[model samples]
Target: MDSHTKSKDSAVCHEICQSHKNKVIKFFCTNHEFLGCKDCIALNHRKCQIDHIEDKCAGIGDSEEYKTTLIELEQKIKAVDAVIKKATLQDKEVDSTYDHVIKEIVKFRKEINDRLDQLQKQILADAEKKKPEDKETVKKVLERCTDLSSDIKNFKSKLQENKTSQQDGQLYIMIKQAKSKLNMDDLKNAEECLEQTDTLCTFERNKELENILTTHNAFGMLKPFATPMTPGKKSVSVKLTDKGEINIKTQSDRNGCQITDCAELSSTKLLLADYNNCKLKVVDTQIKAVVEEKALNSAPWCIAVLPEDKIAVTVPDKKKILVMAIAGKFSIIRRIPVKGDCRGITYRQDHLYVLCLGSKCVLTVDTHGKVKNIISLKNEIFVNPYYVLLSEDARYFYISNQGSESVVVVTLQGDISAVYKHKDLSAPLGMMMLDDGSLLVCCYCNNTIHHTSGDLNEGQTILDSGLQNPWAIYYNHQDQEVYIGGYCNQLKIRKVASTV
Candidate 1:
């Protein structure tokens, strides 16, 4: 036989199982799509139904299953090709789109400059119109004053002269000219013009507009986001699954527990910052109990987790940040004192982002407690940002503003990307990004938990009745549960039930 005929014969032959060198592979598990010998089937897939190899292979290449699979493969290929084409077009248009935006900015700047020029011309013209009248009035008054001044000198000289009626005549003529021009209109107008204080075409600049430009880096916001290329399917709505609540109140706590903030150590464990009682407690979410508790000299407002069992907590009253290691118990490693009343805090990569409620700004600090950058929020839509959160990708921040009752989205480059405001969302507090990439916000005044997309759209109240003034909310995607604490004594644990 030729070499090709020999290769075809070799391919058609059956092989022995690797598990048992002496035994030929005789069975196939259709459910698991695995081939095995008698010994292998008994040990590995005893529960799975087995088919004889020859009988399973009797599909003869024209079966319904094979035809269906071929059609599905072809459809998938077409779908992938369409996605590829769309992505190519999008990539090609990026530069042109950005160029157009640059042109628009240039156009806007020209318009502003033209308007400023027009305004400058108008004010200058007004000053020009008033200049001649004021100048003439002053000149007339100066001339009269000069004549009188010369008269006094002339009178003095004439007194010194031996004998001169000519000197007296000269003084009399000077006084006559001075008195002739001293009319009521001339005197009043001169006095009024000289006594007037400033307001001569002075510009009262808009302090608010100046502040907006000074505080912010740019006028136009450049937002970059990712969208899945897979063909259409809408979002799956979700609700809080009612697991029983955990009462965080302790014997040492004289007042009701104020859970100002919380952090997830794991899917089933959490660390709670009890602001009212000035305590930090670790809780087991699965068992629904407090695992451990630690007392603090000052109230802890927020938590930022660092690598290697380390965490940073912001103490607003002390104006300090405590770096603690939680390997055994929460023990302070170092104290970093900040300038303002730093409340809400989070960290990404090498920097800590702490929100200054009083200053209306955020401070970015390195792991070693050195300040890196200060992001001012004076010009943003939100008035009082009590809480700040860094996005998972570390590209953006979500700030909860109590004064404006809104959530402002900020990029890491310190730009306001979007502002979320709802008529019902009043005095918004803490926020957590859910597993589904939706955001859950605490409406402190409304007594509701609002869920919305990352851009804060298509929102609905996911939890309203259970929690009261839900201040601290934490979510873990692994367990898909929410651990919430608020103004009350009890800390809550709720499951997230998703429905597609």
Candidate 2:
């Protein structure tokens, strides 16, 4: 049955107006959206624009709202189905993951047992290696002592016989001979060996292994995620006081450090893109030193740490995204090839929004680097196209240019929002947004960082010194520090004082 027919039959006063039980709800007030009898309309909806129900339903199927409803219904179904499919895939992944880990655990246990067995065998082999030598030394001493006892017994018998025979000359001669033939060297060797105690072999367990086994909670450790591309909503108007500078320069750097970008691996560790050096370096922020470095096939322009141990580096010359695994060390796990030379890159909702410097456009790509869509800036006075970042709501994003005074605000459809220009925004390299709706941008050539209102309309320089040609920037809210780096300058970390 139709909804209207059901509505009339379902209630005690179904089609009848609640305000006037004797009259049916035949009119719909366009202004107030009310249904009432003639007397009720005169009292309550006299000023409202009224439309008859029949007239309102005349072209319902052809109406825009009806079309929108159809589209929304299909979209909602697809959205719900996508969620269900993802959840189901995740469920299957969980089962497979358990199976894989169990196998690894079994394999690891066997490896541990094998290593322990090898160690045990080595200890036994070492003990046995010296056992025979030591045993022989003691046995030789025992054999000499037994021979000496026999000589003593034979001499006593001879001496007793000589004394009983009353032959003084013979007895004296025998005693002299016995003293001369005593074999003192043999007796001394036995006595010296018996004088000292033998040492027993011992095994000292590995302290490090013992500590790890006793103190650790899991075979593979679990850690919270690293600092994202853009962290929580932090104000750009923060005081960057002198903390210290992390010299990203290393012994292998052939040219001046052109740190195009840097990422925080954790609170204490950082990852830097050495453009001129053609290397990626892992820095120990506490020591202000580079702890690990990985050479790249091409100069790396940007670094983006993605979900679950993955990091992406944009190699513009190579025209590919070097997908790396960031664990204790950086390893090139895979490479995602793009159509054009790529520079600036950011990740959101499992897609990489990359700014292609040569093409002068932004490509929305999957984690695999397959181009899903492109946001072109070929028409605008697009300049450097160094970095692109999505807004907090992901509705729109901003792109920076090194040669232009204005920053480009773009929707997902590639439509321009505004091209606000300012002197302080000169050579803007990297851009970030603050929680208070302020945008933080790095002025590369100006050697400064600027903060503007969320709309990029009003702004001023907050930091203007100690950073030379600042190319990349990061504001860590948890540590209350601002990290800025650039050409000819080591990455500097400054303490963030406040929202002021």
- TM-score of each model, in listed order: 0.54, 0.53
- CA lDDT of each candidate? 0.78, 0.77
Off by over 4 Å in 1: 1-235
Q: Cα lDDT for residue 197, model 1?
A: 29
Estimate, for each residue in 1-500, the C-alpha lDDT of model 2 and write its tens digit: 69877654443224778877788777778787777767777787888998766545655678999999999999999999977865765465456446645766787788789998998899888888778877877788889889888988888888999999988998999898788768467787777886662635567888988887887573565343211222342345655688888778899888999888878788888888888899998888788899999997789999888988888889989899988888867788888887787988888767888888888888888887677888888854686677888776555668886666777777666656556578777788877655465667889877888876666656788888888888888767677677787886488877866563
Who wins the lDDT comparison?
1
lDDT of 2: 0.77
> What is the alpha-carbon lDDT of model 1 when measured against the actual structure?
0.78
The deviation in Å at residue 63 for candidate 1 is 75
In candidate 2, residue 141 scores what lDDT? Answer: 83
Candidate 1 residues 195-223, lDDT tens each?
66243446687797778778655466656
Model 1 TM-score (2 dp): 0.54
